[model samples]
Target chain A: MTTDLKAATTMNLTIDVAKCCGSGQCVMAAPDVFDQDDDGVAFLLDQTPPDTERANVDEAIASCPTGAITVVDG
Target chain B: MDAVPVDTDADTRTDTSSGGQATTADDGAAACPHLRKYSLTPPESRPLDEPDYFGELRQECPASTVTLGESGSSWLFTAFEDVKTILADTRFSSSPLTPGFPLEGAPGSDAPVAVTTMIRSDPPVHTRLRRMVAKDFMPKAVEGYRDFVCATIDARIDSLATLPQPIDLIESFALAVPSDVISKILGVPVEDEAMFQELTERMTTLSLTREEQYQVIGEFAAFCDRLISLKESEPADDLLTRLTHEQLLTGELTREQLAGFVIMLVSAGHDTTAGMFGLSVLTLLQHPDQLELLRSGARSWDSAVEELVRIHTVVRMGPRRAATEDIEVGGTLVRKGEGVIASILAANHDESQFGPSRFADFSIPEEKPKHLGFGFGPHQCVGQNLARLELGYGLPRLFERYPDLRLVDDDITRLRFREGRAFFGIRELRVHL
Candidate 1:
């Protein structure tokens, strides 16, 4: 069931680094999928995580103050 | 909701600072008594608590007109979703220079030019000013300061050991921790900490006349100006020096803007954290069972801090904006050129977002609710990670160190709120160690 869920989920994640305010809301929400550089600009640890991380990613997207993070489901 | 009766004789006055344009829809929205003349200021003397009217308004009229500074009526959004919508929408200008920006302190478009800081400006400008200092306040950046925060907190706690029992926590510990921490970060010398505290006290006092407030502001600004010059000449490994070397030297930031930024950082960083410390300690003392949970590690400091922040939102009356264009929020059509104020304290306690007994319950729930304690959107508190670090390390350790600490006066009514202040905080918490 888990494998099927993962197989069905194909998501592409992207961040507008310019729009990133460095509030770290993304890092707080999904540490596994998101990480910050030494300068604190967010860079994706996982550009596309399994469907299991959908909720976390969604939270990150919602929580990003600048709305910098985006995800497209394929 | 019942259709509010619009007055036939409506006051059609608009913000005079900009192109004086009247609101389009429901010109008499502020005519309704409850909606009209809704006082944004808290009760002059009371326990540190949200006004009962906030709950009433949230339940009755989530979006309504309110009389703000200088007879300016603004759309007050009390609902959780509505407040979030207002914050997230870029159409709402954070700049006081923008016509109809509903705040009293800062200059409007007509007033003499003051360099707009990150919190007061929108997009491109806000984006630029924020980015200059954003790297210094990110979670990872703040993480590196955890040891400094802990040591600072430890030193304050140790000092309390020598002071008399039933000492004022606000003076001895609460204010000192953040003051020291912010000083360390900004590279400001703490040679006269007492003088800094006095100035902060005067600045935060809401009852001060406009002239007195401006006098205090000038003095504070002059201090900041001096600090900027010092940073220019004697570069130190600090945030101020970084701004001076990188942004100032590169001509990305003007000297005036640099001074404004430093003043903004100190004002934002110092009192708010100090306020939170005093309030949080008071709250834990009030709830012994919860305090036990926190002390025993049954409840995490992070969650407790989040909950504490939600319950007692220190920022009394703002996250205000002028509508750059007409926008509908919570079924109310707020017209272009009108101002709006999001009641974050009310939104934090809204039962809809936080579930039942949000007002009464102060526990860490299974699914933690997203709160606007540090506010939301691009202009949210940039120093929040640092504030969180201060609270997270400061609170539990405080309890651990002084297990028997209790409030000197348990009477809530007798306690004084920082009346008429920019932020709501306990003025003085006399505690027995």
Candidate 2:
């Protein structure tokens, strides 16, 4: 029986671009889930990661210096 | 918030006695009684064991009115959430040219335009200027200087070892580290350190009259202009050279703009870090158990530095901003053109955010919460990563080098804080190694 990884861990990632000062803490913490645009504002690379990636996503949210990243559980 | 017309004349200002009591204006108009009066400069004395005065103010009135001497009154936001909101909100403009901009120790009219650089400019302009050198200050870029920083700290400590007992740590070590580090970064010659140090000290002196302050600032600008010219003629692998060679040549930056940038970097690069270094040492010495834990390797240096910054927030008040539009913050309506001051110290110590233990105790928590020590939002400290690297590496090494370090006076009250300065720090920390 194959388990759906996306269904198993439902998390909504949000990035407030206006608030992102490009400190890059989020990208550093979870490179797979977050990236920065040319202007250095943060953007979400993966809106929903597997449950196994929860730790990294949480770290990124917490590490964000401007509190620009938020994660909502589905 | 209520658009109170502030009288700028010092002589005409109502003298609210040091007891912090509400007094009627000279015209017999009743001043807002609820408006809490607290001096941000040399903040009112409180017991060392007790939380800072701002913490109490935050608990009582997170958004209250405060009079900053002749600088005029403004709304003070103390709650962590509100402070963060104000910092991140674009409506809260950083330009001193904006009407009702909250300024401390600056002339009311015709203030030097040079002073309004990246820190005072809003987006597009601010974003452009900040991004020019932002990469140099990032954590990865700052990590490249780790070896040089260590060597500088060791040299300073080694020199202090030969000095007499009960040396003033601020003079012997704390102040020198950042000064030397900034000098190296700016490509300043070792022989010219004395000149730049004197200029920076004079420029940062809050007690100076407006005229006197401007005079010193003018001299500093001239010095920087000369430095920029020298860099243009003989470029080096430093920040100034990089800016002059890359930005100025490309017409991305002008000469005056480059000088302003240099002034900001040279002054801010050293002053705030020096304040943090001195205060962190004082905080650690005050709590010997915590110091012991750190030395014993029970507590990580990273956590210790974070806790140190959390406990002793060097930048007491965030840069003043004028609300561009009416906004409700912490149940108070800050009207358009109203000035706002984010009480960083109060927010850093908010019990709600950090909990009772970590808020009160100096012990490093297992989980380090996000702190406003480096501030938040676009205008948050640009050199934070560099400052962190310096503190993280410098503090541990200093303690390890002098394991038997102790204060000359155990009484916290005996320590002289830098009164009237924008930054909060111990002026002269006498220590015996």
Candidate 3:
């Protein structure tokens, strides 16, 4: 349960529009972490998102419609 | 949308003013302090009804409130708008270190210390923890497996065609589809699948006691421990080995951290998909024309995935937090440290937001179903892309294979929502192909 996570600074969420299909799942799951551009593609509201929003992001990651959003950490 | 205007008294904390007994300023009044006691059903039943609890609470208290038994933490924020603000804001944190945490589904223990996981962390720790899993689950990473996922589902459906007479819909198709997909992705060996299924089922049950929770977790933990050891000894390109040898090289995840990731993937990934698949078929069966169109093979299946799952919020309610300091949600006051459950089922059914078109409308809504099935805010489900792979590819292929698929039974009410349920689903759904 206790994770020896190195550092959260390596965190960056990448959204692939081609693969995304504009399901808006990432936008729904973690609104602050993902945003919708006019074209309906998801853009980062905050790639390095806050801790409080992590659970929602996790839920979003769980809820994605297209599976377009992926979290990348070093 | 602006926060709802509160009636001042809604914010005042009430606890035994002078009298030692339960006090309602007046009977039938919607007082904030006693929100949890206001049952969705009259207090005569042995078990609680989940949908009614969510539906009733959403209707009665826009920003739902509850008083915990042990922790005594007052919860507020269920209205769709409030949930959005609360989960995104940083001021109110989901730092699991509640002053006195309510042991959800567990009682008889005072000052019970809550268990910790990535879901329990806040800020930097959460960021670091989620980052590791994020890499594997990203849509791009998951998208590569789409063809494989589609093949898995298609192969099973094809095999089902070879069978005689009527078969159980849930066992034959619904459950088989996702379990097969997850097992393949996790690189689960064919010989160990039933064991995998047994272990994962216990892993996701929220109603179990803390000890039972730990026991199931232990089974899974042990499985992952053995798995990692094997993978470490003999490296492979599978996810488990990749995490153990390659990605984990930087020491980002400890042994427990790695095991937690595996447990989450196995448990959260499979169960919800089974529920979602069953619910979608039920939704379609209720609407004949839509099922006909979906089976018509004229319309593209891409649009149907989001639309179907949005309406059938599989993971209907998710526990969230009011991240900011004293955020006013839907006009009600929720202080820092209070928990919130986003009743996505109500939000999905809201006529004010999602138009009142009964379930069958195939035309993508002018506004997509804003239901928070997966969740809203930072902590959404990581395995969602994989879920999409199942829904997007699986449903259409299903109809294509069985053009005349329909439910044999009319009364699905008996299979209605369970009491105090954490997951959203019906008991037994039978469909005839």
Model 2 chain B — which ten-residue stretch has the worst lDDT? B1-10
lDDT for residue B195 in candidate 2, whole number 0-100: 84
Off by over 4 Å in 3: A1-74, B1-30, B37-60, B67-76, B100-102, B106-116, B247-249, B295-300, B322-325, B357-367, B416-421
- Across B1-433, the per-residue lDDT of candidate 3 in tens digits comes to 1111111112122222110111122334455542563222211231112334555555665664554333243354445655565555545455435432233332211111213345555555655565555656665567678888888888888887676646566667777787887777766666666676677555444445546656767777788778778778887677777778854566877777677667667667777887777777777666676566555654445555666666666654345343334456555555444455445555655545555423434344433455666665456666776887788777777877887887777654444343333445554566667
Q: Which candidate number has the best lDDT?
A: 1
Candidate 2, after superposition: displacement of residue A4 in Å?
A: 4.1
Q: iRMS of each prediction in angstroms?
A: 1.5, 2.9, 9.4
List ranges where model 1 is wrong by over 4 Å.
A1-7, B1-33, B40-46, B105-115, B355-361
Give the per-residue lDDT of model 1 (tens digit) for B1-433. Answer: 1111111122232434432123435665444345555454433343455666788888887776666445566777789999988888889988776777765432222222133667777888888788888889987788888888899999999899899787999988888999999999989888845666676677665555445655776777677878888988999999989989998899998876777687678877888988899988988897788887876778788888888888888885667888898888866777778888887888988888775423234576544568999898888899999999999888988888989999888876677666656666777889999
The DockQ-based CAPRI class assigned to model 2 is: acceptable
Ranking by lDDT, best first?
A: 1, 2, 3
Write one digit per residue (lDDT tens) for candidate 2, span B275-311: 8898788878878888887778787888878777876
| Model 1 lDDT on a 0 to 1 scale | 0.75
Better candidate number, 2 or 3, judged by lDDT: 2
**What's model 1's lDDT at B239?**
93
